[model samples]
Target chain A: MTTENHPIDQLFKEKLGSLEKNPPAGLMDQISAKVAFRGKIRRMNQVKTAIGIAAAMLLIMMAGWYSMDQTRIAKNQMPLQIPQINTPALAKTNQESLDIKPTVNQIAANQHTIQTTPAKNTSLQSAKPSKSLTVQKNKVVSASVSDGASLLAAQTASKEPSKAAKQEENTVKTKAAEEKTVVKEKSKTESGSNNFQKKNPPLYFADAGVVKQTPSRESGKGNWGITAELSPSVASQSVSGATANTTQQSTVSGGMLASYQVSKRIKVSSGIRFSQMKQDTHTSYTLSQTSGITYLQPVDKAANLAGDVSLYLPAVSSIVYSNGMKTNPTDNFTSDIAQELKYLEVPFQATYKIIDTYLSVGVTGGLSTNFLVGNHAIITQNGINLSNGSTGNVRDILFSSSAGIEVGYGLAKNLIITIEPRIKQYLNSVSSNDQVNYKPTQIGIFTGLTFSFN
Target chain B: MLSVTQLEEIIYKCREENNGAQTALYRLFSSKMYGVCLRYARDSSEAEDILQEGFLRVFTKIRQFEFKGSFEGWMRRIMVNTALEKFRKNDRLYPVEEMSIYEATNWVDETISSITADDLLRIIQELPPRYRMVFNLYAIEGYSHLEIGEMMNISEGTSKSNLSRARIILQKSVAENFGNEKKLVKKVL
Candidate 1:
């Protein structure tokens, strides 16, 4: 690069043309760590976004399903018809009722059977007058048994010549007993409709050839679940009427849990969850030496010589002999350092529900055992690293107690999503000293998705 | 010395996130990149920072390179851009009117040749950021005034003025170091 042989351009092209100077040590590490950290943060944000979307989708699907269920239940809850055959036997009784939700066709079949039973019985007896009562009873009962004549067959039969008189009495008594049960069921249905107008009434009933079904409350008593939980946590220590602020970190925990429904409103659960905590701590402190040694590190040689008057033409040599490098005063030097610690924790917790419904409000408290996994420390000044080593005498095992309120929503049958804001209090010190007993309390908002195996 | 193929192979491994290859690549090109950074930076530490930042970008955006030109030249451009970015961040546009313009002078051949790379680098560093940028772009990098102006977000006239000011300062420094020269030592590097 020359401009009509301009001396300045000539000087650059000839004397100060190409250069090859090694960069100071440890620069590669800086670049690598920063790049890796950036990539990790990017990946983490993506995962968080994905999880958030999945949770939202689940919520939408659950809401849709719930509304669909409510619509179907409303259609089914319309008033049912009463049997006209035995109106006199309609009586109410005090007994714990069974709730069985059957298909719609089952209710129609019951009403048909009650209306046709008496006429079918009379026709059968008239057709066989001389046959024994046992034979006659068998003949009276139809193949589908829609007449419910099997109950009439169980009555005491008179061998008297007056067959019509005995038959009529037996028929009336059996019809009355059947009507009494129906009236009790009808009263229950009316009371249930008053209590829950939105709910569908039980369709199944006790009868010959109609299968008795158990209630859904019994079916919902599931005892086991697997939950996946994640939380961003911050830990701090209580020290001499002041709290030492620690950096915010995150933990991911999940495990299988077993629960016992001890009563209608209470449940006890225990689970083993694997979790972790990470802290990157930066600190500044004074470091004084007995007889101070000057830290003579390299400085910007170009910047140092820019203003010095006599230093431009220092004693002729390959390098400027004097006043080339600069030094910083270390007489009252302060040190800046970093330390990182990690722990893998196993938590065993119990939960008690207060308001258990479609949305349950619960109080959960538990203890966790923490195991130290990784620790690293590095001390650097400005940008130059001074020292790197290990931390000593740190406790390996620590115990902590955690308690929180968990609000859970049923996404679908046996699938639940919960958000729990919990606080953990460490019982033991992280350091191995009595005086430096740093007990940290951490607060975290945990989100979990649970699937139940009933 | 490593061959071009070897360097390319290291780059390939680096693309695969091989840490050893990344370190090898850094060892291969760091010195040259550091030299470029020094001319653009105010101090040695700032130069290291620029070099580090440039290497990181090289690794992150290595896939963008089509391998159409010299890899060293590509890395040199990144270093220059990194330095320029530092200036952009600080808005380092010193008022041109505030500068005391000195007359350009001639120096001795011995002085021209004898000026240590460090001494020349010092004089360039002492120039105001704008002048330093223009001098590096025009004199060392061989960018035209118009291109320098576009790159630095300044008018062509401002770029020319800054280069002239930088040359004046260097000329004054040389006149102090050693008088005029008849014949210069060739190829000092």
Candidate 2:
């Protein structure tokens, strides 16, 4: 019942089980090439994923920084309230001291009243007390002398004239000595008040007792900032050796940048940027078949990021019709092939401020390391996609240098809106293929929102 | 032929992705693997494709191969799986009509000896894709009907049926190609 013992199984196994045939030549080379290429692609994908995650984290950090900065600015804008003192009570004490007559006992009592006053009053309040005491001492001294003279005249009529005159002379001498002492005390009080005024200059106006503290404009200056920039980029390329006519197409570029202010007029920045170059070539091609697989082979090399059309078209060499049938070799086609190359660019730039003010202008220049992340080429005939593939000879890494003028306007205490018109030129050829030399140039007016961390 | 120690050394080098070692390994096993591919492939070109893809997988995934069982057996399994995947992608299984059972033909040893492996390979390749797969897995590879069903994504009954049909068609071809030769050999005897 076992199929193993069956005649047909026995026959085929005995004859074909150990059969070996030499495979066609050059297959090993093909496999090796594929393995290396796939390895590169795998590594590229890993790097791209890492960059993507890092970019996302950068954005989150920027958002958090911006939110915290706004809160700080709001707190800074709030008005400062100065402590109010009971000025009327102090004025009443001054009036009461002034109205009392300056006998030796009354003078001693006034000195005690001045010493007992609280020290927590404003500088003006404290100075007023000393000034008022000096005035009171002077007024009391003069008024006491006048009253004593009047009392001496009244006493002459009521008693012995000689006895009265001798008593008045003793009383006048005592009053004159006390007035000299009061005058000396008043001069000391006046000097003390002048010294207090000199030491504690009033921050608040005497008339308008409230203090309003506005945050200084210099508080907005910080060493670090994060900018999110975007631009509609115009991409073009120069070709040294290519026959096909190629036209540049407009694309978009943007990124988040972290900047550090090194000095008042100089700033350095580094971050990730995304850029793309697209080109369309109108060319003629011949349909070729290899091992029953159809291919659209270009007649001439096209000027592109890859520099050659063969690399793009040969990747998906087989051309399948709309009905899922392979195309015939006899079919010759003329079409426009569009190739787009995208890169993840990391730029190290420095900006020098020409005018660092609310409306600031700066000149920026830098070099960027661009990693090729996306490369795609597609052929379309009459709105139908004929074939799609990727450019092969495009370099994985490219170097570019950019220069621009940055014009920024301060929108808030911690925010600025900037517009930078930049021109980037590739430092090396985009293609690794030796058939053609291609270098792409890009111009973009980048508009960005910058948040400062002070 | 490589000794066990030498084979392990080559495999070690392959794990490091040494191109020389990879090429050496390919040179050692490619012919045998291509033979296996040819049985499952419709043509030499398809066999070459399978061999190329299979060797690429072997080189890339060499690190995953634990030195448990036979290395050749592991590689053979990869080649077969590669073929099966290609078959699944390229061909859809269609329902086959009920066929008459093919009884074993009695032939002289000389007539059987006259048929070469290439002739048998050609006949096997001519079978329908599913039947060819089921027959190869069941007959030459010595897999069970249930195992063939799982590998080919068919029911066990369907596997058995396909193997029977494949055998019937193969038997008719062998008989047609070698029946007259057997008669001539009998006449000479």
Candidate 3:
């Protein structure tokens, strides 16, 4: 007979065997789908928000530049307008001769008569002699001699009366002379006014002439001009406690650029742009792994410059007025937002040319489509075995909106070489993942060419 | 009742988020898992408590299972972990042992193999806690002396001695049950 078995073993085996007969419950279905869908929608909204904010900011900047450009044109034209006013005044003075000719001749005749009459009165005063006066005999001798003398004196008296009359006339002439003095003073003032009018003619004429002569002076100065610029810019940033360790991420990537004018500044450009940007980042980390003893290790290294490209549909508008309104120009190249990859932005820059050739500074800003293509992962363990097993996966979206200055010089009439170091900072935290902590903002540099046209 | 292929399929499907498969899986494995829980428990009720908790954890962590080795081997590890946890909780239940004079008792070949399943079960029930645990793990559960040593944190020699003592006690009880059965047979005759 077979050896009898312990009943507990059979019971244990039976219970173990009986597990084949039971099963667990089902899971809740709709909640999981809702969570996944919400994740996709949230990602899309984040991208749109980045683009929208960039567009609004660009619009504000372009508007500011356009207003400034208009003011500049007005200032340049103001000096030229002065000459226009002077030219018309000179022409009016020439036309005034038609009205002044008759008055001039009449005044000359009156002046000549007044001058000769004064000379006759002066001679008559000199010819008169002083004499003593006696009574009757003196009057008789003076009468018989006075008869002859009387005749002579009467004649002389008559002559003297005539001379006295002439004197009276002379006194009238003096009064006339006084009146003429006022008229001459007025004519002198008129001539002085004409001289004042002559002085301003050259100012208005020269300013207007310079402006007219300068219409094509900036011929090679269009949108594609090479520009070389250096911007000493600084950004103040406060990162969250989690991102503080990655603070070496702050960077300055600006350089001198020379660019030519591309076109009459873009009023608005509605097209796609392909942009590629590269960033060489160096990170220094000090990691201590305490297995038995505390091992302190410092790693200082630079990562290869990574390239990012974005396809942007930018609604680009000009910063300077095309048809005198703030509205953008109606052209094939004009749009409301200049869209491109935020990281790899082909900036449909609305550039306002401040000056030309020697030192031209333009403010260029546009919209960018922020898309996250890849990410960097940092696995850190503090008293936790982070790499031991499959604990969790962390996903973050860093550096969404990209912006910076593009400064350079005009290399030629049609080419502007520029260097743009951009900063892409995330508006929201990169990690929506609750399990792991991550850092999200990044800075980079871009160098490219611009073609300008008139 | 489930074949190995069936168990593998159920676990795979459950990991893939199939509800019907998960339920089938739970039903198929629950009873045997209950037995594993019973070994580490002080009573049937405690065993049932462990069964529920163990199954819940097993299902929750099932996705982490990489099909590298035998599924049964994995399950066994989980059951042992559960048992060790119970032992830690009930440490006070183990009776204190005192060294005494060395004497070997008569070891009978009680012919336990000839006894009915019910009689053998009664013999196991009559054993003290220390003896029962040792005997169950060594004889029925197929744990080697070394494995038992590691699990209970004792020397392998201690596991061997405990198993030997438990077997002797179980043998005597089985002999008595047989004697009683013989008397009943005589009476019936």
Candidate 4:
């Protein structure tokens, strides 16, 4: 172009030319490599955390399985000392039989004299029969017939009569002894019922026709035992038109547990559960809202990544189930929690049991809070009408859920090694900011150990 | 004018961690960006500082670029932001109220009509930092007085007044040097 007759524009253009002569030194390589290295470190740290969580979960599961197995074995050995009670009753029965045989023969020899001395012998014989009857009744009390004296007393009435009048007295004594013996036998046959039957009576089975029905319904309240568990979890949130974040949440919960075997394999357990939880949640905000997208001039794109400090409350209560059974290997020992959210976060996870060698996979979800936290720009539509004037408010809260699978190795009678992988997603919106649509989701792998007392 | 595809390629290369691509892109835009930075800086060195920092930020955040408009335009805004940062850090800006457009429409003195472009540029560079910043942003850079006022933390009226003062000073200098170019032209003839 020809120079402008207006010289000021030309001079201004010339000065611009001069200014171009000097350029800043290049430091791009240094800075770029540093930034990249930092990024790599961050990624590495994430991997390390994931691995650690898996290991911890595995440890917890292994411990639980080991403890459960130990409890089972201990339960199996419980009836060891208690069964010996039957031996004493058998010995007493033998002693009573011996004493009765000799006395019975002597009563047979005195039969004729017993008949001739009727009036005089009547009261004496009646008194003796009554005394023996009283003694026999006392011997048949709830106590086991383990005393030799009680059996000897039971044998005395069997002797003393062979003639008609004497035989009648003998019959009365014999009947009483028979009744006492029958009571003792019944009590002895009911050894199984004696233990638990006292605590829970079989009122429904009280019919005499139901003989041989032990009063104690073997409520095999799943061999009362402790359960230790370690489950590896993953939770995350994502933003629309931006990067996704996946976080790992590892937890170990277990304590002294008492289980009553309600059946062969089913048990209801109640105990204190103290849990240690660690969560590494990563959140990403798309810089779309802050970007110069609408500006007439160019601007750099913006994105923000932040980490959260998570805290979990301890849980306590009864664990009701069918047969101390792990319904879904991947999904075991889950607590119910309520939350709100804005994103579609799907988390994938793998978990392992160190002791039982059990492994499983699961998934869960949570929503991003971007719209809820920073600018609150996300406008929500109350699928229902809200009392507030605004159409939709910030959805800072998220709904979190998980589904998973588990694989385990039975290490001991009650111990198992397990691994479970799970995925979690936030179903709620993460941003109240209209400009951002983010949800939190995560995927993780876990390894742990579990113990069952069954 | 580069096609949108070409712009995307450049941006991609820069994001792929290519140093050469970054340097090339910087070279292509440095002149305009330096002009922008100069408007907010006290001197060329300060302007260069802003340019370097701004370019670094541009590369760092290249992934978020959502090609809403011309890529150059977007980058230009970043450089302006960098300049603003420097201005803010140096406390070189002040607040001024908006004046009517008519108040800012004053003309240069006819006495300086004969002055050369180079002489006018020298006068502009010599103005105080604030006046020079207002003049470069509003007049040379084609920024609206409202924008200059916002960028410099001043009212639109103050930006207009500063620009007017800058023009008056430049015109006076031009008048003083008005005869020099004529003498040089006569010598060449």
Candidate 5:
């Protein structure tokens, strides 16, 4: 049971126990490199986690702002309803009541002469026959009939100037008595009529010079809008300090944006978006095992421009090709590797409108902060995933700037459909590895529907 | 050779992650630790790997050493544990066959004296992974069967069996190689 009594254990221990041999050269350097690399990786992970938390907080804050803005807008809006009246019928009734039979030819001839006087013509021409001049709450029932009597008095004055003054005085006195009677009738019918009459007051006409101006409905339209945009993006990467044969593949990007109209010509927006960059490279690699884990190490490490193309293979006993064929592991093999890098992009953009109309055109430009969210590298032999691993040395954050020309068509009074052709270029390299500089560029046609709110 | 006071100073500096102190400490102990790694590794490359990995653990976890015992002993334990982890990861993928127990052969004292440590190391590296691990843990490191079994994830009975099998193989190899040399020398005389 004891190793001391065992002859074989004793003989081997006595020979090998006190032996010492110098290790191979450069082992210490390798350890130092690994330690520094691991430290960098830890720092990058911390930064990534911080960015993720900040992005979540921004989303929550934006949602809170949107809900509060909706509540405020709902509280500030008031409704006004105007009644429709037939202008010609009221004019005929006023003629019969006054017993004045002025011929149509005579009125037409006097209309030209009335246009020569600037003051009278301005007052007469500015009147809208079908629209109400004033709105009052539950007290304007006979306002339309009074407006008709005043229009008839004006036409009669154009015919006979002396009688016109007396006619207008009589019309005003009669309109005052009718307004008092109508107010008393409305007061009596208030309880009998529906609640709509209390909620939405009626429109009425006042004397020509005493009319109250209604607020323009177009004053604050389209001040704030939310847009959901989707785009099919084409992504490409530019490399410096290294050479790589890579072809970029198309991917999809989309996000929701909230915009505020700061002025008549300028608008600003901010929101979160999802974007990706994918590329395929045909390269040669050798399988190297380290610490019981096998790595598909690229033969030309210098060609690793993006830092996301390294593959770690743990238990690759056999390789299966795309045609469902198996092969033993070799020292070196040529394969197509696809590298995908996805980012959570937060963009701050501003647009300047060139033409604001039913159909609008604008120029847009801004910058975005891109946080890396996904990194994957797959080794495939004719479209088969033989082995999959993650790339290393990717930066946690990247900054990109974009510009575009936007064309939009108004789909409705409060909705517009827009198309933007944009190009985004990264300002810095996506890889943290000092030997390689990999910056990606993206082009997309973004189309979105915007719903406007005051 | 480093004095006790100098070694303590190096440990303090290493705790602060000073690169120079780490190099000094490694220079002081790496030869002895590499000798330890070679006994457990199958080849020189694997021994280098174990050395690198073990030293990294030592430098990163030096703050926890607490100066409770010999710093050298602590580093040796880390090297052994790193080797054991590598064994556990690889043994499942490349399972070794059980070796039959060989009859033990006795060799004269002169023949045993002729065998160098390098020759013995070459012989031990040829043993199966599990047997080699058990033999090193039991014979050189002075671990009991129970402790070896717990570290290697095996039953104590299995550990004893492996140690027995390993001794038989090593005993047979030493006797054959050196016993033939003794026979040649006597024939020439």
Candidate 6:
């Protein structure tokens, strides 16, 4: 549509085009009022959008920084992450002066499996000194054996093969004690036992607990410890009357746990945790039949005062609309509404270590009380935030029980990495609504890093 | 009476939302923009309504102007847009005829300049909203049919048709006012 040969264009161009006639009187006042109004509205809308974006960005940044810092702190806390109480005791076995004979002595020193077992003293010279130290192929395993008793025990056992013929002439009577009840320090030097006795630390057993305990460190029995666990929880809701399918998005739970070893193999623990159960109930609820015609405004004034329950009125002329618009009375609406319930859970659990080796396998069962911190039931019609509502008749206190198998690996001396695939069942309904008995259950694999205190 | 620099200073001050500068700025351009509003509107009161609305937009969006092009031209565009918005809202109500009339006629005869701008303005105002809006955008404002279509929210073809209809109507108005070429006037009638 090019204007190549238009005629009337020329006439209008000549006549009224760019005409500068004066407008009506006092028009400026009207303009002033309107412009001021527009400016206020525009500024308000811009401010609202800015605030929303800023809040979302701030939340994400804080969450990311927190996660990174947590990982770094947890990493710095494992196998011998705690300082050694006696360094010379740890260094005795690491001496490189050993020829092939002492190297065989190192293999003898590593026989901790027999030493730790009271029933069968078949010791294994375990070579894990620290979690950070990766196994070096040619490096002597003696560096990992911190105790002198084990080194002498291995050396004596290895020396006996050479002296087997003369064993009757040199019968050394050494008293070997139970694994936990203290064993008196004993060492038999090949030439003279005095040199070996002098090299062994006078008293290392009392201060030995200062070194970090690896979760499954064969000889490690931790006294006291703390652990932090994080898990992504999957929750499903079970109700009584109406059929509702509930789905959750991004349900994460994190908690700090503290444990005290009641015995050598059992630990009693308690901790504070944060967990949320968000349920999106996709349900078609039938409205009780109204006898008279009820005209609902898109933004009903009464909706705000609905007192803990909001009726999500949709913007449709098909039903009873605000401006006296009416339609056929009986139509059931099937829409989605998001209901979130947050809890500050306190769990009192006991863990029994089945095999406290390099990889510790344990069975854990816990009783937790989930305080119904927040329950928000927002009624949305076609994805519009109509109003704030309550999860009607929600019980404040909820009791739950959980059980899981905790598998912990000694990452370093004091630091242990653990994973527990746990399932929690609600003892009572989270919702007190008689018509809907909503009991939610969550299952997740909880990952944690444990730091030993003593 | 103000120089270009003085006008710009007033505009800058108006952007800061000074009442004095805003009134001064309004006084400076209101007359010329009112003339534009009159062409699009049905009467003086409607024209005044359009002028008031356009000026309100000008004041609210004063900060957006970087002073690159002509200030008057920018103001004119705002005024035209304000008029067009009014037209879109009320376009269906206003009466105009079918397009597809013959084109390539002599624009206005020897008596074209004899009629006053006000008289031509009146003839333009008499047109239905769509025809009047298209005619004013294409002829007076020097916008292309495509531009008119975009401004008026219509197709370029529709723009051209409306322009043609506006022209045929104006030709009869011109012929009747000058009282010449009885047959041509009757043909438009």
lDDT string for model 1 (B1-189, tens) is: 889899889888888878899899899889888888888888898888888889888888888878899988898898899899988887654654432323445565666668888887777777778788888888888888888888999998988877777776666666666646323322211
CA deviation > 4 Å runs, candidate 2: A1-3, A77-454, B93-101, B180-189
* Candidate 1 stretches greater than 4 Å from native: A1-10, A13-17, A59-454, B92-104, B179-189
Judged by DockQ relative to the true structure, which candidate is superior, 2 or 5?
Answer: 2
Docking quality category of candidate 2 according to DockQ thresholds: acceptable
What lDDT tens digits, residue by residue, belong to model 3 across residues B57-126?
Answer: 5655678788889776576567656666666566555454432221222323364345554445445555
Candidate ranking (DockQ, best to worst): 6, 2, 5, 1, 3, 4
TM-score, ranked from best to worst? 6, 2, 5, 1, 4, 3
- Residue lDDT tens for model 4, A240-336: 3433232334433233333344444233334332222122222321111112111010011111112211111011011112122222212222221
Task: Please tell me what DockQ candidate 3 reaches.
Answer: 0.07
**Higher-lDDT candidate among 1 and 2?**
2
Global lDDT of each candidate: 0.55, 0.67, 0.38, 0.41, 0.65, 0.59
The true-versus-predicted C-alpha distance at residue A153 of model 3, in Å, is 90
Q: What is the DockQ of candidate 5?
A: 0.37
Residue pairs whose backbone atoms clash in candidate 5: none
Instruction: For candidate 4, give the DockQ.
Output: 0.04
Error of 4 at A442 (Å): 41
TM-score of 2: 0.43
**What TM-score against the true fold does each predicted structure earn?**
0.40, 0.43, 0.28, 0.32, 0.40, 0.45
TM-score comparison, 2 vs 6, better candidate? 6
lDDT of 3 by residue, A1-454 (tens): 1122544344334433223212122222232344346456667657645653444344334434544653694343212101111334333422331123322222221111111132333333233321111112210100000112211232333344455656654664464455456667778998998899788542210000000000113533333233222122233233232211222322222212223334533222212222222221223223222221111111321111111111111111221221222322232111111111112222233444444343444444444343343332221222111110111121222333445554544333333344456555545433343422333344444443333344
Candidate 1 lDDT over residue span A287-336, tens digit each: 22222121211122111110111111111112110122211233222333
- 4 or 6: which has the higher lDDT? 6
Q: Which of the numbered candidates is closest to the native, going by highest DockQ? A: 6
Residue A80 shift from truth in candidate 5, angstroms:
16
Q: For residues A1-454, could you state the per-residue lDDT of candidate 2 as single tens digits?
A: 1356888889998888877888988989999999999898778657655654454355445445544653684333222211122456544443333433233223322121111111211122222322212222211221111112222233333232355444544554465556567767887897998899799853321110000100112223346777777676897767655566778878667777888777777778888887888877877667654432334555664444455443222212333332334434465667777778889898899888887776888899999999999876766554433444555567899999999998876555556667789999999888887765777789998877666677
In order, the candidates keep a fraction of the true contacts of 0.55, 0.69, 0.16, 0.05, 0.63, 0.81
Second chain only: TM-score per model? Answer: 0.88, 0.91, 0.68, 0.70, 0.89, 0.88
Model 5 docking category? acceptable
